[model samples]
Target: MAQERDVNPWVKMGLELGPVIAFFIGYNRWKDDVFTIAGTDYNGFVLVTAAFIPLMVASTLILWRLSGHLSRMQILTLVLVLVFGGLTVWLNDETFFKMKPTIIYAMFAAILGFGLMRGQSYMAALMGQVMPMQPEGWMILTRRMTWFFAALAVANEAIWRLMSTDAWVNFKTFGLPLALFAFFMLQGGLVRRFGLDNGKG
Candidate 1:
C-alpha cells in the first residue's frame, strides 16, 4: 500500500473532494445532526461537514509539505471551497454547497474565454504537462473546452434550480462523473486532430 502514496496528485483531489461527498451523504442521511458535532455519536455526514475546514487545511499543508509545490489552479480551487464551504457548514444549508460546482465551472469558463480572447490557448498551457501540443493546437483545444465548461456550469444551475435536493445529490454522485467521462471521449478527437496521437504520441 506504500506505493499508493506516490500518486499524490490523485490523492490530493480525493482529499479536496472528500468533504463535498461527505456533505451529500450527511445532509441526506441526517440533516438534523449537522449541528451535533460535539458528541461521540456524531452523524457521519454532519461529522464530515464539521471537519471540512480543518481537513482542507490539513490536506493543503500536508500536500505542500510533501510536494513543496502547489499549482495556482489548485490554490484557487481550495480557496473557493473554503469560502463557499464555510458558508455551507455554518449556515446549515445546501445553497452554498449547491453553488460550488457552478462557481468552479464558471471560473473555468472565464479563464478559457479570457485565454481565447487573448489569442492564447489557455487549456493547452494548463494541460501541457501531459501532452506538449503546439500553441495553435492549445488554442483550438482551449476554445473548445471553454464552451464545454460553460455548458457544464449552465447545466449545474439548471439541475439545482429544477430538481429536488436528493436528485441533485444523486446527480453529483453519478451524473457529473459520467458526463465528464463522455466529455473526455469527445476531446479524444481533438488530441488526434492536433497531430499528437494520445494512443502513442
Candidate 2:
C-alpha cells in the first residue's frame, strides 16, 4: 500500500474537486435542455445529479485506491451523495440534491459536537496527521469548527432556498470551498500558537 504522503497533494485534491467541477459544467451545458422520461420532465439540476452520482462514485474509488483506505468522513460523504443524488434523479425533484449539502454540514457539526461533549475531538482524529498540535489546540479548533459547520449548514439552507438555482450552483461549486479555505487560513495563528513544536526550542 502506498503511503498517503507518497501521493501528490494536487492529485488528491483533483480527485475530490473534479466531481464538483463536472457538476457545474454539466449543469451549465444542459441547463436549458429538458429530459422527458415516463411522462415526467427533468431539468438541468436533475440531469447533473444523475451524472454526478456516478462521477462521485468513481472519484471516491480512485481516492481510496490511491490512499489505500477512506476515512469515516469520506465514506459518510460518499454515502450521502449517493443517497441524496439518487433521490433527486429518481424522484425528478431538485430539492433532494439541494438539501444534501445542508444535511452534510449539519451532520458534521453534530458529529463534532458529540465528540466535544465526550471530551474528544473528532476533528483531531480526522486532521491530526496533517496538522500536529497539542490536545488543547485540537479541542479549541474542534469547538470552533463545530460551530463553523453549523453556520455553514444554516448558510447553505438559506442560500438554496432564497437564491436562484444558478446562484446556488455557483455558491456550491466555488463559494463554499473558498469559504472553507479562508476559514482555515484564518486559523493560521491558532495552528502556530498551539502547534506541537511550539516549545521545542
Candidate 3:
C-alpha cells in the first residue's frame, strides 16, 4: 500500500502514464503479432487490442492494490480505461488506444465544469489530500482548473484527430506532462499570490 509519504509524485505519474507508453510500444513492436493474439486470422486491430488490455488491467490492479481504493482521479482514469480499453478489444482498433486520452480529458472537463456550475469545487476535493488550501483558495483553484481541463480536452481531440500518429505518440509521451507541469506551476504561483498554505498546500 502507498502511504502519503511513500508515494513519489513522479512515480505516481509514471504508473498512471504507463499504459499509454505500453500501447505505443506494443502497437509498434508487435503490430502483426497484436492482431494474431486471439488467432492467426484476427483483425490487425485485435493484435493491438490484445496487448493493450492486459497492460491496462495490470496497471489498474497494481494501482488498486497500492492505493487500496479509488481516489477521484483513479476512478476517473479507470472509467476511461475500461471504456476505451473495451472499445479497443471489441472494435479491434488501435486508434481507440491512441484516442483514449481525449475521452479522459473530456470527462474531467465536464466533471469540473459541473462542479463549478453547482457552486462547489470538486477538483479541490480530488487534490486535497496532497495539497491543503483554504476554502477561498480552493474556489479560485477550482475555477482555474475548470478551464484548464476544458481546454485540454479540446486540445486532445485536435491533437489526436488532426496530427499524425508519431506526432500524437510524441505528444502523449512528452507533450502532455510538460503542459500539465507548466499549468501546475502557473497555478502554484497564483495560489501563492492568494496565500494558500505555503507549506502544506
Candidate 4:
C-alpha cells in the first residue's frame, strides 16, 4: 500500500469544507431562481444540490489524490453525498438532500455502537492516527462519541423537519460544525488525562 502523506492542515480543512461553503454560497446566490426541467419546475435548492454533488465528488477525489488515502468516514460521506444528492436532483425533491446528514450521523452512531458491543473502539480505529491515547481513553471517548453522533442525528432530523429550508441550511453549514467543535473542545480534559505522553504531540 502506498503510504499516505501528511496533508497540510489548512489544505485539508479547505478540501473538507470547500464544497459545503460553495453549496451555501450557491444556494444563497440563486435561491430565488426557478429551474424548469422536463416540464417540471425545480427550485433553487434542487439546482444547488446538483451542483453540490459534483463539488463534493471533486473535493473527495482531490483529497484522496493528495493524501494517498481516504478515511472510512470520508468515503462514507462521499458515497452518501452522491446517493442522496443524486436522488434529490433526480426526484426534484429536497427531502433526500436534507436527510443526508441525519443518515450519515445515524449510520456512524450505529457503527460505533456495534464496535462498543464488541468491546472495540471504532472511534479510535478511525481517529487513532492523530490522537494516540490509552486503550481506556479510547473506549471512554468512543462511548461518548457514539452518543454524540446519535444526538447529532436527532438534531438534524429536528432542524430539517421543523425549520425552514434556509434555517436548515444554516444549521447544516454552521450549527453542526460549531457543535462538533465545541464537543471536541470539551474533550480537552480527556485528551489531557488519558492521552499518551500526557497529550504531547
For all candidates in order, the CA lDDT equals 0.71, 0.91, 0.71, 0.93
The digit string of per-residue lDDT tens for model 1 on 60-155 reads 777776666666776887888688878866666557767877898899999889877887876666668777765667777787778888988998
Residue lDDT tens for model 4, 117-199:
99999878778879899889999998999999999999999989998999999999999999999999999999899888774
Score candidate 2 by TM-score against the native. 0.93
Could you give the C-alpha RMSD of every candidate to the true structure, in order shown? 5.1, 1.8, 3.5, 1.9
For each candidate, how many residue pairs have backbone atoms clashing (under 3 Å)? 1, 0, 2, 0
State the weakest 10-residue window (summed lDDT) of model 2.
Answer: 1-10
List candidate 2 segments past 4 Å from native.
Answer: 1-5
TM-score of 3: 0.78
lDDT of 3 by residue, 1-201 (tens): 545335566766677788778766765665454234445465444565566667777777776666665577777667776787688777766578667777787777788788888988896677766676777788888878777877877887788789876677678777888899998888866667655557643
- Show pairs that collide, candidate 4: none
Error of 1 at 44 (Å): 9.7
For candidate 4, the per-residue lDDT at 24 reads 94
Error of 3 at 4 (Å): 7.7
Flag regions of model 1 displaced more than 4 Å. Answer: 1-13, 32-48, 195-201
* TM-score list, all predictions: 0.76, 0.93, 0.78, 0.95
